[model samples]
Target: MRQMGRTNRARYLATFLLGYALSGLLTGTWTSVETLMDYFKYKPRILCVESKTKPYFAICPFHKEEDLLVSGSIRDTGIWDSDLTHLLKVALSLYKEAMLVDLGAFIGYFTLYAGALHHDVLAVEPSNSSFKRLRQGLLLNDFSATIKILNKAVSNKRSYVHMGKNQKLNLGKMHVNSEKDTDDRENALKNEMIETVTMNDLLEYIHVKQAIIKIDIEGYECKAMEMSTAFFKEVFVPFIFMEWLIIRTNMNSNETACTWTDAKRLVDYLTGLGYTPFAYHPVFTLLDPSAVLDWEIDNIFWQHKNAKSLLPYINLLRKVGPKYFDKMDQNQV
Candidate 1:
């Protein structure tokens, strides 16, 4: 009976291993192999990596929270958001004097990359923990002089808002509540009062006339943009990469942000400003302005339609295209 039981257990183990191997190959997710590769990418004690040779970027290692975002790809996967990063390079090429603005900058992945590229940068982070980490990353990369960080929220008004942190994983992706709305008693104690600034104020603070901006400010992007009509009309923002995956209509249950009407308001506003739309996911795709916009896409790219200098580069992007294949580079760190 004991011999029979041992044989059954062995058979079960063999079946499980075989199933895993087949599934991994079929789904293109070989977790064990990827784990081994990421393991060698960074030194465990230091929590930082290099791009080629010189020290590139450092991350906040507390619960490895910073790694949960774009920095994770930069450190573990050997590649970051090459699409947006590449697009940034292209825009910077067009406007040589423009600055890179990373709004809601989580530990400064894009900001660090831009700073390393030797461009002036402004990284705005509202969360305290993330702000501290972003500053540390700048100091580590030796970009303190060129890259300035603002510990404030980008909002419709220049006032204080209550922000609650995601203690579970991301300390940066906080839940912003208005001073008028105090219904969330659960996270009330955890919520901190953070000062807010408008998009115009941000650009003015950095003395940036022409700018390339990345907006990842939770779901307040629409509100901020709506409030910054004057800034958008006056500033030379040739390019903007904005987070489009909305907070949904029912903010409490995690559904759409307010029927598609609210999102349309945002699109209409941008279109009125002479900006063309593009989606960042499934590659850098050019979106038809007349078609129905999908708000579920993670990120959206907007380029000035009237900029004469932007015409050629955008046409070339449509012709050649950018690839985001996360290839394992041996010296990626």
Candidate 2:
């Protein structure tokens, strides 16, 4: 009996040790030595950047497929989506009076750049942690007054929502939980209840005549759009740029992050609004409304007929191919 007890204890200890090792390994998987070095070196600092035509301040970003175009691109360019950033500038110049409604503004790259140009802007971020970072980054600029920051998530209606975490991604990818989905009651209750605003409700805050809207709400954008029908009807949004990862139909739900049914609804809704979609390969190419799943663009512009006045600029940009603005050195990153 004594020998048997000894063997069992030994086995138990070995098993416990193995489990602990695996847990540490799994937790530290993404935290490579290089990532650790970068974290310590540049964790939280304001970067002064002269992005060609626009000089702005960017806050230290969290680890993201963004900390930014993601894959740690900020270390090189001190910017992400340079193509999209410049594109917004051009849109603002053409619209002149257009307000930039930057939803999911994520560290305020688009908002920072637009506000630096002295454009009226409303920037929204859902995550408290990310919202703090975004606000700090934007406020460090001289044109901070030009931007209005909101810490609530935008949904189809005003309500309380539980925010969900995608550990695989960064805070910018944090999303509103679908009422039916969450890990469990205990953790759900622990998570902060986020307030939501309908897109139409946003209008009361900004008297937007024409707007350049960027919505990147992870998978929740489809649900948010359901309530945004009124906003689209009321606002003259010439450029509605969105992340198609949540609405593309060609891929399975894993890739699109939404069902084919939801994707179809989103696409139909935009089309019914008389918006034509355009993507750029080497130049801006008009996309077939039904086939957004096949689009190869990084992001898309749903151009309404109202934006025809800006066609010459779009044509020129595409002719020049995609321009990448701001290649700052390590200190700026």
Per-residue lDDT of 229-292 in model 2, one digit per residue for the tens? 6677677888888886545533465544356667667778888888877764345777886775
In candidate 1, which residue ranges exceed 4 Å CA deviation?
1-46, 51-67, 179-191, 247-259, 288-296, 308-333
TM-score of each: 0.69, 0.72
Q: Model 1 over residues 1-333: C-alpha lDDT tens digits? A: 011134433443344345445546776755355423432333333244443212234443333454355545554544456566556666665676778888888777778777766679988988776775575456445565688888888877776767764745455557566533333444533555677788878656567577788888877777678678667666688888887664432333433322355566777888888888877566556776555344446778888875534445445555666432122121221
| lDDT of every predicted structure (CA atoms) | 0.62, 0.63
The per-prediction tally of clashing pairs is: 7, 1
- Could you tell me how far off, in angstroms, the CA of residue 331 lies in candidate 2 after the best superposition? 32
- Model 1 C-alpha RMSD vs. true structure (Å) is 14.7
Best by lDDT: 2
- Candidate 2 has an lDDT of 0.63
